[model samples]
Target chain A: MPLEAPVEVMLAASAGNVLVWVVWVVAALALLSSGIAVVLFTNPFYSALSLIGNLASLAVLYLLLSGEFVAGAQVIVYAGAIVIMFVFVLAYLGGRADAPWAGGPTLQAAAAVVAAAAIALEVIVVIALAAGDQLSDTAEVTGAFGSPAEIGDLFLSDHLLAFEATSIVLLVAAVGGVILGSAMPQRSKAGAD
Target chain B: MLGPGIAAYLILSVVLFATGAFGVLIRRSPLIILLALELMLNAGNLALIAFSRQLGNGDGQIFALTVMVVAAAEAVLGLGLIVAVSRKRVELDVDKLTTLSG
Candidate 1:
């Protein structure tokens, strides 16, 4: 009996791979719980830490989705640089963890919740409809899917304008930050003098 | 053979977005609001990458990268503004920022 590749092996290899499932579950849980911690933690400092956790978990999720470059950017830009900025602001603000927060107006909170629920339900329904007859297995990931080279090519070729625009935006943001930071001290000094 | 599908990823994105929305509404601190906004942006990136994977296209990932750059810039400028506001000893609560509330 000529044995072709066994069904079990094929099933174990692709989307049904147990490792993928485990990683997905872990990453999703981390993404969610850390997000909750960000919102619930009273201390803004703690919230920043939680946001870092959330960002890191999101990086992991990006990796699981086979987006290596995105995952790296998530770690570098978000978990590293952005979170550090948040911490600096927290520290600059005296790291006051005990700020009194009499949670915002109740009506606004209820409105937000309702809006969020409605949006969530709409998204779930759309996803369900979209995926109803189209639950395909994970695509065969080629070597070039999320590689830096592929992304760079895309940036240089198709997304050149947008890429250049982003650079300009970053430069502007930097200058604005400097201006905002410097102008304040002088004004405050003037007020004092 | 039930591996996570596009729907699963989409559901996660939706949940994350909703959490961000809830945070934006419930939290008064400008910093927390910025963090929540980051969460929402990340959610958008996640969805983009997921679709990129599903469609076997690189465009989504590229867009996600662009979004990350924008997010970083936004974070920097936002933190700067927050610092400027705090320097004046103005209350950080959003509700109390009624200087322009006509």
Candidate 2:
């Protein structure tokens, strides 16, 4: 009775509980389908578009979980910025790029399937075992839970070093990107000389 | 309070991670590989945020933000490398374009 109390109360108290369930179903379905589409589609452009769909669904799920800031970042950074970069490169590469599944599953592909399956099975079993009794009811979240202000405070206080390290990482990545982008042209120039 | 519980989210994360790994392995295009990598990273982010909600705190959210920045940087550098590779090589396949140097 005690175990079921919180869940039952949550269901009864919220009129929009059904809507949340529906939204979760829809977003989860979109996430899975678009994820599959991203992998299955041969055209990189379609794959990029599919990735965008996947990102959008993930953002919606983040909203359901009260991760408003993460939801916003998922939309902006992933769907907005990263997917755009993919499209630009796809445009540059054009349609002539070689497709992957040209003939059939090679030895490598078969091995990949096996490896992925084994890892997934092991992890899932652990989750099912450990998560059975503990996570039946959700945590009692505070008013400030998942708020940007709270998370920002954590960034500047608890995780300050990590935050600064991330900025340095971004700086390095930016420099790497610029140099890498120009690398080929400089090589060709050297060849000409 | 996603209705299906935290376990559902965890299962979903596993599936997404598996799909991404499969894509990364089978796909020949560098761009698709990068896309798959994004999926994998987002899979981790999903789990982190789900736990953040479950714990009633902002720790996981902060971690998720850090992940986003890293993912962005990774995508930028990866795309740049793809562009660099495309210029010299006629075939843009990862398998074919193996060697780093001439």
Candidate 3:
């Protein structure tokens, strides 16, 4: 009974527990708000804006998780490139803001819940399996979370084929994009007037 | 240590993926759907990195890199087609773009 009656010990544990709760609450709120914005906005520009905010928040989450490389990639490729492309396309293909054609608000929400459930289940299974057994001792390493040099070395070595294939894929995509983009109708000189 | 960890990262990714999936399913604009699809792919990237950290394996990071490259390529080509389609009809609405509607 004496061992369990330590006031100092309880105070320290409660402090730590409260801190964790606060952080988790904030992260959850940001993520959820962005998700709602993605749906609630009818204008495509606003939707793209919401998406950019979501990506930025996710990048912060990646950093908090000690994923420096991933955070960088999330910012550069996603926030920088992908969102910019989306904005550009929306601008280039100008149209008046019209009512969203997405039918049945209730149906959309229902489908979202089902899909979220499936993704959550898969994640739970993976985490459970991982916790049950020692898959690898790497995560336990003290300095393992943000090792960019090691990541770079592994990228050029063990994953060489994927790297090369990705380059090829990009090249083909660029060529195809150019050809297809150029083929779009040019307003005939006489028709323009 | 109330710092965020892999579990927090995972839950956030799941939420992002769900948002993207919802957008794809409900949005009638092809361009908006494409943007949402990118969001979903990004959610996958976050997971790959989280799992890579969990397993202490570099494979997840490598896979994520490949995915980014592929996503960029897809965006370029996909948008090109979208431009062509829009020019012909000035309709970004998915229902009208369908030439094969039965």
lDDT of 3 by residue, A18-83 (tens): 876676567567766876676557777887788777777766666555567767887798778877
Model 1 agreement with the true structure over A34-112: per-residue lDDT tens digits: 8878876889989899998898888888777778988988898887899998998888787655332355446776788
Off by over 4 Å in 3: A1-28, A95-138, A142-145, A184-193, B1-5
Clashing pairs in 1: none
For each candidate, the alpha-carbon lDDT, in order, equals: 0.84, 0.85, 0.72
- The number of the candidate with the highest DockQ is 2
Model 1 error, position A114 (Å): 1.8
Each prediction's TM-score versus the true structure: 0.89, 0.89, 0.78
lDDT of 2 at B72: 96
Candidate 3, B-chain TM: 0.90
- At residue A190, candidate 3 shows an lDDT of 45
Query: Number of clashes in model 2?
Result: 0
lDDT of 1 by residue, B1-102 (tens): 234877688789999998888888788888988998998998899889888888788999999999999998898899888888887789888889889888
Interface root-mean-square deviation of model 2 in angstroms is 1.4
User: If candidate 2 were superposed on the true structure by all CA atoms, what would the RMSD be?
Assistant: 4.0
Worst 10 residues of 3 chain A by lDDT: A132-141
